[model samples]
Target: MAALYVLLAMILVVLLSPLLTPFNTSTQFSDAIALPPSWVESGNMNYLFGTDDLGRDMLSRLLIGGLYSLGLPILMVAVSSLIGMSIGALAGIDRTIKYQSLSRLFDTLLSIPSFLMALIIIAILGTGFNNVAFAITLSLIPQFIFVTRNAVHEEWHKDYVTASRLNGCSKAYLLYRVILPNVTPTLVMQLTVSLSVAIMDIAALSFLGLGIQAPTPEWGSMLARSLDEVYLSPWSMVLPGITLFITIMAINIVGDSLRRALKERVNS
Candidate 1:
């Protein structure tokens, strides 16, 4: 719980810091180019994390970049979960030939690595935040579909579901009123895990020049831009890398904790 609180605080900082900070993320101060972290006497305290090659404030960029890095994945997961849950629920309740075919189609999509699928989709859709989010959502939908389908299938056979059927409940009523509620905990857990993967995928695409474009403060693009300045100002690269690492780790910890809690409740 302490870890979760700390993680939430970090997320709030990332999401809100740009608005709170005075520095402009895009404005370049020529004097501050490639400066190391502010702790060094030569560096300016104004730029706490340091300045990039173009003299953009590292801290400011990170905070602004959070809007993209964090925002896109969250949107992607939500859209994916909605589509996945709908299809999965239908398949789980119906068990028809059409649903089975849809399951096989999801399996086929799953066989391809999500990053690879995103690349392929991006190749067709061109590049932008919306396109990237759509691509990531496409890649993620299959996992949610599988998870929700399996969870719903298991819940469908439970004693409560059987009792509901015996009471002359319609399939729609059972699905919406009973099965979905029972399977929701598992779905929530899957959503958390998927969010972490979505972040990594978004970053990878940006690193490959297929995601958010240059001059943007996205962590992946920041890393890409910092490569040439690695010897001169390594902190530029390290800061964004650390930011990404910590954010993902915190999300995973929270997700895992929730999963354990859910399991314990179920067992009890």
Candidate 2:
């Protein structure tokens, strides 16, 4: 199911790439600014989703915008998952207060509101794709650590873990060879869920002008820039918003399915 979700998203992005993204992402065709969806405007075949106040194609902007909105989250998720899973696996195998202490530090992080954390980070780092990713990664790492930590803790208690330890397996071998395999399913499920949140968070940051910036074709920033003219060109708002919704919804559906399957497998 997770595979299905990923496949669907990749296929959608690929199919939409040429038709959806801005023809010249950096160039501004001001003459076409604020045009309505082709269906709304007579004799205009271009701008299927309409144009922004700058006459930019809404559909094109949406397409390119999705690249950032989706791209950042996917990157963050991959980085965080690797780090988090490793940390968690080690903590579980070590079974020491140090791991608990490390986990506690992340718990303190979890106490702060995610948007507030991102805002604070942005305030220091300033707005850019890298800054936004850093801010979100900081906010999200704790979840990965916590989930991986707990999953590892449970795996450590399994019979095979004890058998591996007693069989004179090295610490590294026990973690990599024995524990890592057992925890992968849980880790993958967590990644799916975390990826969804990452997507939503970055979009929110872009909406606030603290992420991706203008003229680069990001959904949040596009929506932010378009909100003022929603009445004039509803597609300006609708197109980006719908894309964000669909992407998040698709991620969630996949995450939920993965979670259910993992739970069922564990039970069985």
Candidate 3:
């Protein structure tokens, strides 16, 4: 099944991360530079996927780079989702003009393209993982905000929310206890979609040289580096490109399934 393959791939990456990364990929070894894949080399386990022009182990770099690539987006999506959801929930609890004004501003923000917004942020803040996370979070905040605001607004109009308010529940308690739980199914689906988008955006930024720097293992940077020797060792491009593709595909598939399941449950 597709799920089984994805699960297996996920497990393989996590379990093999430590073992797969070469012990000293930084050490220069010109003699081994641009070696073909192991399939082409007899009695050579050193370069499983082969070596780059700098003789860096492709397999090792893939693991370390993948860790960097995946980790940033995961953290960015989580923090942004929490922040956006909180703001949206608070805005929905308002019965006045101020809340509606804030909600409209959030809607305006959602209208901007995330990539352009992130590009501007990166241009202002500079590169590195922290900057990447900041850009990604900012770019995705509107999505979570919109989802949470709408969910809370709908829940606020429901009988249960009115009943809670009648029972002397404070706005804070009502939002946390009554509104949040009801909206969680929706939130999960939103988060999953946001996470996938964040990952793609992070990778795009890195590919454009506005994200993670060189000598630091990252899927996009690796792809960028491979271009020079791509003609000589096509595997240089093939391996890292495949790695990025598979990881993104796996995340997307999982997210799509979650979204479908959540919608079905809500409808039922």
Candidate 4:
């Protein structure tokens, strides 16, 4: 519950961060360059978290960056889940040669680490927000495919599914209405894992200079930019690092809680 609240609050702050601050991400305040947090001796209350080397408000940038950090991954996971689950369900229900080939392909892709796969795709596509998003989303899809396919396949072979099918339930009905419910707990677990993967992948890409570009204030990019001024303004690095850690930790906790709840539900 606490993790859920944190996640929700983070989402709200990021989504409304633009309105929350008087400054835009790139807006520079020449007078306040490298100021410390307001609590610091020389700090100004006007900039709650202080300013970067470029005089950009750290709070504003961090808040805005969260949109890319968490928001984009949320979107990426959703897209991957939809496409992967559809293909996985079809493959689960039908043992056609084409589906078998696709399963092999999925396995092959999954064998390669997801970051490596995204790097290969990004290398081929070249770097940009669209390309990175595409690369990451594609990398994410196979895991969903593997999980959903196996889950559906396992459920399909179960007695309940056989009884449903024998009672004239259509394949579509069985896949959607019957198998889907039973497999949801597994899928939910996978969803949390996928979200963490998406977040790290995107951040790693940006940190490596292969994803979001400069002036965008992405958390990963912000951290990368802060490295140069680490000694001068340690808070710059600390702020984004802590934010990323907290966000990921919150997500993991929430995921764990949900899994425990679902497990208890099953046991009961």
Candidate 5:
């Protein structure tokens, strides 16, 4: 329950941050560069979180960066899940040559770690936002496909499925009316897996300088750029790191709680 509230608060803050930001994320304060958080002797009251090495306000940037860290992954998961569920479900329903080939290919791809897969794709596609987004989204799709395909395939062998087929139920009807409801929990569970991977992938790619570029207000890049300034201003690193930790933790707890609830409901 607490985790859910924290997640909601983070979402709300991310959504409303633009209006709440006190300074332009890019604006530099020449005189106020590298100050610590307010209350520190060297810190300025005007800059509550102080300024970064570039003199940009930390609080403003943190608020804005939450969007990229939290937002882009949501988009990535949506895209990957839609495409993956489609391909995976088709592969589950149709054991044809083409689908088999595609499924085998995904199996091979899944053997490679998602971050490594993203890196390999990025190597071919090059850096920058579009390429990184494409790379992460594509890397994540295989997991969805694998999970969804397995879930759907399991349903196909069930006694109920066989009975439905014997009753002359169409493939579409079986899929929508029978298979989907049974496998819905499994599919929804994969959502958390995809979301967690997406968040980590974006952060890692950005940290390595392959994801969202500088001045983009992304948590990962903020962490990367702030690394050297840690001694001078630890908040630069601590803020983003803590935020990432909290966000990921909240997601996992909520996802686990949801999975349990759905399983109980299905059993009941």
Candidate 6:
């Protein structure tokens, strides 16, 4: 619960950061280049977190960067979950040769490392916001597909499902109304975990220069930009790295709690 509250507070800060800070994330203050964190006596309170190599406020950049860093992954996860779940559910219902073949294809994709898969996809599609999201979605879809397919397959074999079928429930009705409901908790847990993976992937891609481009306030790009000045202003890199770490950790904690709660409910 404490983690949840902290996560919510972080999210609110990210959303309202622009309003909270007067510093322009893009504008560089020549006089404040490589400034240490404020409260160090030499640092200006105006740039509380300090300035980067280009004199951009680290706090302002981190807050604004988080908007893109967090937003894209959420969008990617939602899209992948929708498409993967639908396809997985359908394949789970139909054990036809074609569907089985599609399942095998997803398995093949899953065999590849996600980061490598993303890199391959970026190579083909080139780099951009949509492309990066699409790449991450592609990389993540297999997990959702595998989870949903297995869950639905299990639910389909249950006594309740058989009872429903005996009551003249149509295939579609059995899938949507019966199996889907039973599998939803598992799917929700999968989504939470996937969201965390998506966040990491987005940061990785951006760090590799395949994602959100320069001058943009993205956490990964910020980390990449700060590398040259690490010896001078380590906080620039540390701030974004810590932000990513905390956000991912908080999300994983929530995901774990959710999984436990769902498992308890199932046991009950």
Show how many residue pairs clash in every candidate, following the order shown: 0, 4, 1, 0, 0, 1
**Index of the highest-TM-score prediction:** 4
Tens-digit lDDT track of model 3 for 1-268: 4964874676567556877666565755687888888888441577788888887787787777766777667778888988898878877788678878887888998999888889989999998878887888898988888898888999998998999999999999999888886687788878767876887787788888998888887888878887888898788889878876777777767767766776677668
lDDT of candidate 5 over 128-168, digit per residue (tens): 88898899999988998998899989999999999999999
Error of 3 at 97 (Å): 4.3
Question: Which residue pairs show backbone clashes in model 3?
Answer: 65-217
Candidate 2 segments exceeding 4 Å error: 1-7, 10-22, 41-43, 266-268
Model 4 alpha-carbon drift over 4 Å, by segment: none
Candidate 1 local lDDT, 46-118, one digit each (tens): 8887888888888888888888888778888998999998898888888789998998799789899889999
Ranking by lDDT: 4, 5, 1, 6, 3, 2
Q: For model 6, how does the per-residue alpha-carbon lDDT over 89-194 read when each residue is reduced to its tens digit? A: 9889899998888987997898998778998999999998878888988999998888999999988888999999999999999998888767777888898889
Kindly report the root-mean-square deviation of model 6 from the true structure over all alpha carbons: 1.7
Error of 4 at 214 (Å): 0.4
lDDT of 4 by residue, 193-260 (tens): 89999999899999999999888988899889999999999999999999999999999999888978
Query: Between candidates 2 and 4, which one is better according to lDDT?
Result: 4
Where model 1 places Cα greater than 4 Å from the true spot, the runs are none
lDDT of 4: 0.91
Error of 2 at 268 (Å): 4.1
10 residues in a row with least lDDT, candidate 6: 258-267
Model 3 collision count: 1
The total number of steric clashes, by the backbone 3 Å criterion, in model 6 comes to 1
lDDT agreement with native, every candidate: 0.87, 0.76, 0.80, 0.91, 0.90, 0.87
* Candidate 6 residue 46 C-alpha distance from true site, Å: 0.7
Residue 91's lDDT in candidate 4: 91
Q: Which pairs of residues collide in model 6?
A: 65-217
